[model samples]
Target: RQHSAQTRWVVLNLTGEAKSWTLPEASGATAVLLTTESTPPTINGNALPLRPNEGVILAI
Candidate 1:
């Protein structure tokens, strides 16, 4: 993940299927789904679906 101080935004790269990470500092922080090769992604046990090749910014 890349965090930009200038934009105050984080860029997360999630690949493959059924992948998850423990982001303690990401609590209450927003997430933007940059890309998806197949199925959508989930954050914090919540379902955040996205279309193929879609760029959707979501609030996690």
Candidate 2:
């Protein structure tokens, strides 16, 4: 979803195993605002790793 100043992306790992996702290109910087997992949020380059049944909210 998009708002006046930022875009929000919701990513989920529905499978039982971990998964990696390449975030969509954004006009500005991106940050992980919220996550289901306890670990600190980190994105490797543009790739995000999600544990099983995890979800995240990204802002750009």
Candidate 3:
């Protein structure tokens, strides 16, 4: 997966198999939909910090 963050947008990009469901969008640098119990945002295969004004980028 991959993502690019902005002031009010967080793009969740998938580099793996497609899922039956799609993730939602984030606004104002806040991502709530990506923070689930089953699937969470990670960095280098490890969990990254969810900060206030920064983005957590993931690569696959």
Candidate 4:
């Protein structure tokens, strides 16, 4: 979702096991804005690791 000058990305892992999500190509760097889990998984390049039932909001 985009609003004003900020673009937000929402990622969720609904499966029972860990998963990796490939993020969309962005013009600028991305960062984790919010997460549902206590320990958020690391962002590997454009790929994000997400635990089961985890969700995150990213800023780009």
Candidate 5:
């Protein structure tokens, strides 16, 4: 999947608070957190958070 245009940086804002949320990720797709926050978020039962001014590239 080289140079595939299926990667997207999704930003999530918790308003400086910790919260639980869900996103629409493609089946069997992958996601990478690009944030530098001390506490990483969770996704689909996993700890993958996106801090302020940060993003996660989701493979769809």
Candidate 6:
């Protein structure tokens, strides 16, 4: 638990009009990291697998 940070999220500020971004085509990046955490997530809970879809951003 020492090096672990219970981050609710990692974020960047957005200052622009509404538009959809296609990563590789728009930004010319092969991949993007969502967080600084080196270890990837795995299934460990007693629940169904997640269904991927549009990401949600919330204002704190």
For TM-score, candidate 1 versus 2, the one ahead is 1
- What are the lDDT figures for the candidates, one per model? 0.55, 0.46, 0.38, 0.46, 0.52, 0.28
RMSD of each: 6.1, 6.6, 11.7, 6.5, 5.7, 14.2
In terms of lDDT, the best-performing candidate is 1
**How would you encode candidate 3's per-residue C-alpha lDDT over 1-58 as one tens digit per residue?**
8776543434654223321233343324444223222233353355545433344433
Q: Indicate whether candidate 5 or candidate 6 has the larger lDDT.
A: 5
Local error of candidate 4 at 1, Å?
20
Of candidates 6 and 4, the better by lDDT = 4
Best by TM-score: 1
**Order of candidates by TM-score, top first?**
1, 5, 4, 2, 3, 6
Worst 10 residues of 5 by lDDT: 27-36
Tens digits of per-residue lDDT for model 6 on 1-60? 465443344342212321222233344333333221112222122221222322333222
| lDDT for each residue of candidate 2 in 15-51, tens digit (9 for 90 to 100) | 4223334445662445544343523234544444655
Off by over 4 Å in 3: 1-10, 13-46
Error of 5 at 16 (Å): 1.9
How many clashing pairs per prediction, in order? 0, 0, 0, 0, 2, 0
TM-score of each: 0.51, 0.29, 0.22, 0.30, 0.37, 0.19
Q: For candidate 3, what is the TM-score? A: 0.22
- Report the C-alpha lDDT of model 4 over 1-60, residue by residue, as the tens digit: 855655544544434233334445673445544343423444544444654346666655
Model 3, global lDDT: 0.38
After TM-score superposition, what is the CA distance of residue 23 in candidate 4 from its true location, in Å? 0.5
TM-score of candidate 5 to 2 decimals:
0.37
Per-residue alpha-carbon lDDT of candidate 1 for residues 1-60, written as tens digits (9 for 90 to 100): 986544234555567774454445745455544455546666566555765565556544
